[model samples]
Target: MKTPPDRSGITFEVGAQLEARDRHKNWYTATIEKIDYDKERVLIHYRQWSRRHNEWFQWSSPYLRPLERVSLRRQGLNAPMFVSGSKVMACWTDCRFYPAKILRVNKDDSYTVRFFDGVVRTVKSTKLKPVDEVRT
Candidate 1:
């Protein structure tokens, strides 16, 4: 079977939660406020920051990304046992939430996450939170 055609000029939806970058390039949790399909841009409000800081970026811009998790590649119609190119916040060594990407998934059901700043460590699943799923 063939995959359905994607919606033209649309990548994300309004009110969808996401991880976004601030002007200083810091990664933070945010939610979609609005979208301009004609321009392919999205307006986002930072979760912890004030509404005054809301900003817009092209919908497909790297600044906007799915919340992260321990992503698996191609389990292919097997058990619903694998998972995304998603973005999520994992507690760093300092216990602060930071934007992290999956470097590896350990057989122990833990993940080896590497922050954008070059810090890497093996972390249990409990310490990770999906970007959109996190309430704050």
Candidate 2:
């Protein structure tokens, strides 16, 4: 691809951790595996995914975004953070965040959430982010 400057204004170097949107519209944590400056293509390896899932995308593709919480909040994607009965993105073992609903909060600040798949689990608050954090 003859890539142009990233429309998102992102300029991440190789090995930078970020988030990438998949074909299904889900955002998953990723790392910049390589960059072909001449071709303007970036090789990304999805966190927790095998090598086969790594992909090459045009540098300017909107499918890529910063994963830093501060950057996300600065983009106006912040909210009350987390609370009971709120919609959230819960991180699973696959390192992919999935949409879930908070059922309650534990004394230790952990949260009991029920994923859309009907699986329930108590996850640390650090492993979750508000669903609104993802700019549709």
lDDT for each of the candidates?
0.68, 0.80
**TM-scores, in order shown?**
0.45, 0.48
Poorest 10 consecutive residues by lDDT, candidate 2: 1-10
Cα lDDT of model 2 by residue, 1-136, tens digit? 3444744435557788878887789888898888887888889999998989998988877888877754555454445357799999999889899999999877565789999999999987789987776486
Candidate 1 clash pair list:
66-87, 67-87, 68-86, 68-87, 68-88
lDDT of 1 by residue, 1-136 (tens): 2321253422366776767888899888788898776676779999878999999887667676665321221222222221323456888878888888777766666677777788887776668887666476
- lDDT of model 2 at residue 48? 93
| Reference-based lDDT, residue 40, model 2 | 85
The prediction achieving the highest lDDT against the true structure is 2
**Where does candidate 2 clash, by residue pair?**
none
Q: Which stretches of candidate 2 lie over 4 Å from their true place?
A: 1-9, 70-136
| Cα lDDT over the full model 1 | 0.68
Candidate 1, which ten residues in sequence have the lowest lDDT sum?
Answer: 73-82
